[model samples]
Target: MEVAGPSFLLLILLLLAPLSVHSTPPPYLSPAIFAADYDDMLESFRIFVYGARRTFKFKSEAESLFLASLLGSPFVTENPSEAHLFFVPFDGDLSERSVARVVRDIRADLPYWNRTLGADHFYASCDGIGFGSDRNLLELKKNSVQLSCFPGSGGRFVPHKDVALLPAGVAPAGEGEPRGLSSNETIEHLAYARLGAIKDPGLVHRLGGDPGLLIESEPSDRETFERRLAMSEFCLFDYGGDVSWIGDAMRFGCVPVVITDRPIQDLPLIDVLRWQEMAVFVGSGGGAEGVKRALRGMARERVERMRGSCVAASRHFAWNRPPQPLDAFHMVVYQLWLRRHTIRYARRDWS
Candidate 1:
């Protein structure tokens, strides 16, 4: 099952064509194909976690927790030889030098690292990988799959080769349950910010004065934030190239109103879900007036339908104790599954 050398390079080049810089709108592979092979993923997929169990749980180390989860899961194999994918549990917060050292250690200790030149290996991170040393690990960057919180048209993220790690927690620690608003109680729109300034300077000033929206720089508490999210017909998500908050909007049953100039794939689960059903897109260049026009222009009935779909899509973002079916954990696993199956190549280059 291991493909190497020139054959592996050819397969990667061919498969990555659609994900190249100049690709069209519907760029990802059909989710239906993944759905059909879901059972095969559960039945045959094997992963080798390359380290000891992590005892310390840092909030930022999602990769650590993911490795722990897989260690206890059915997909993990005791033998590395049978593993379809190898997971290098590199902490996202590691210094560039630290990252390079870890990669060097893996290369020194493991025969598998050189077999396909890390083609079937993967690492997960809550923050996007942003270090030059990390990026300079040519084999890792070129061949390995990255499971990251941010997936955009950037050097760090390669579509089809990386999976978006949905940031968990519907509300912050000690927050109230995610409750839906009654049809009559919903606000026209809601926008909240716990941290970081709005990427667009004029956006907050333009939207802050509007009585139809529950817009605030920061909510008083988690209750207030969750309440506003629940009570909104639509939640504005001004993409700053970070996707940490969008899941909360969906979790509370408010359709997301994403303002991004980039492709839809910039958001999580773009490969699997039909985003138009649950989210509204406004061009970032359109400014606040454009967002207002788009939201106010939608039919009331269509808004309700999208809200319902948004709630359904939120379940995929949930990460359970042991990991559940179709939750964030399984979704990540399925992405790795896709990589495992798709890279298989058998033809000889006779020419």
Candidate 2:
């Protein structure tokens, strides 16, 4: 597994060549079983942020903009030489050519990209899998750490290498407080659910008569939505891998019932967070009826326990200004710290 010192540069070149693919999946280690020392991460980790200029074509760059603002933060270094990681910030829609141009710019203007062929770098995007069609973007996904909302191994995300990033504007800055029902509060509703608009019509038609569930398609204002979410015991989401809805549900003390066909790796923060404790999963194999059975079968005590865990775990999904301890921003950084050696192992010919 070790790369010889002399062949390191040659390996980097090989990784940089077009059509060169690293197919070996990274080693799998669950962070849930072990405790992460945020103190250690704070003391040892530093990142150098790339000041890439954006043309402001798209309005979906909030995540990148927020991280870009961290250039002067304690976790950031003025000198790239002393940094353990590099941050690439981009605004506007991502395309194959646009992605390639950004990397080309970095390789031409800086010396660091040559060091690891982008294995030591990372970026954030709220737009999930929309920019994944291009060859250059696929290469970037393989080598660079991609902080994205839709992280599925079958598509754009590489689990151990990439981190699940929270979408921008989901949780306001400095708003990490749990907003759901108290332990003693009377649980009035069983669940507040919304199947994605794209969900199968037959499935929705079948679940409409379930008395235990309140499935709403009517658009509600943010205030009303949160109000309803806070009252429910469980929040059902089939939003096609939108992490914001999951975060909102957890923020409101509603245990999530995620119904998806994607692999478990698609879930955000699965590397560190124990999702089974905080949320319920319903696979496509079981169909819509499986979702109902899973929710209805839970005992009151189990429901309460899961609800509490949702509140506790929601902090990791909240984005705070200046990056609060264990918050979403810090969690993403911690994931990077966990994969700091990605560069050294970048040359493995998993293909």
On the 0 to 100 scale, the lDDT of residue 288 in model 1 is 78
Error of 1 at 115 (Å): 2.0
> Runs in model 2 with CA error above 4 Å?
1-36, 52-62, 126-139, 151-154, 173-176, 195-198, 218-223, 239-243, 342-351
- Provide the clashing-pair count of each candidate structure: 0, 1
Per-residue lDDT of candidate 2, residues 1-351 (tens digit):
121121334433432232201121111133222233444566667788887344333334446544644553577777776778888766547665777778778787877777767778887655434345555465466778877665333566666777766555457534435654655656667777665622666777767677766777743777777766777888876646434567777777788887777556756666666677778877766876787788889897767667666665666676666555556776677778877753443323321
lDDT of 2 at 31: 27
Q: Which stretches of candidate 1 lie above 4 Å from their native place?
A: 1-35, 54-61, 126-136, 151-153, 171-197, 341-351
**Once model 1 is optimally superposed onto the true structure by TM-score, how far is the C-alpha of residue 99 displaced, in angstroms?**
3.0
Q: Which one wins on lDDT?
A: 1
- Model 1 pairs in collision: none
TM-score for each predicted model, relative to the true structure:
0.77, 0.76
How big is the positional error of residue 83 in model 1, measured in Å on the Cα after superposition? Answer: 1.0
User: Would you give me the overall lDDT of model 1?
Assistant: 0.64
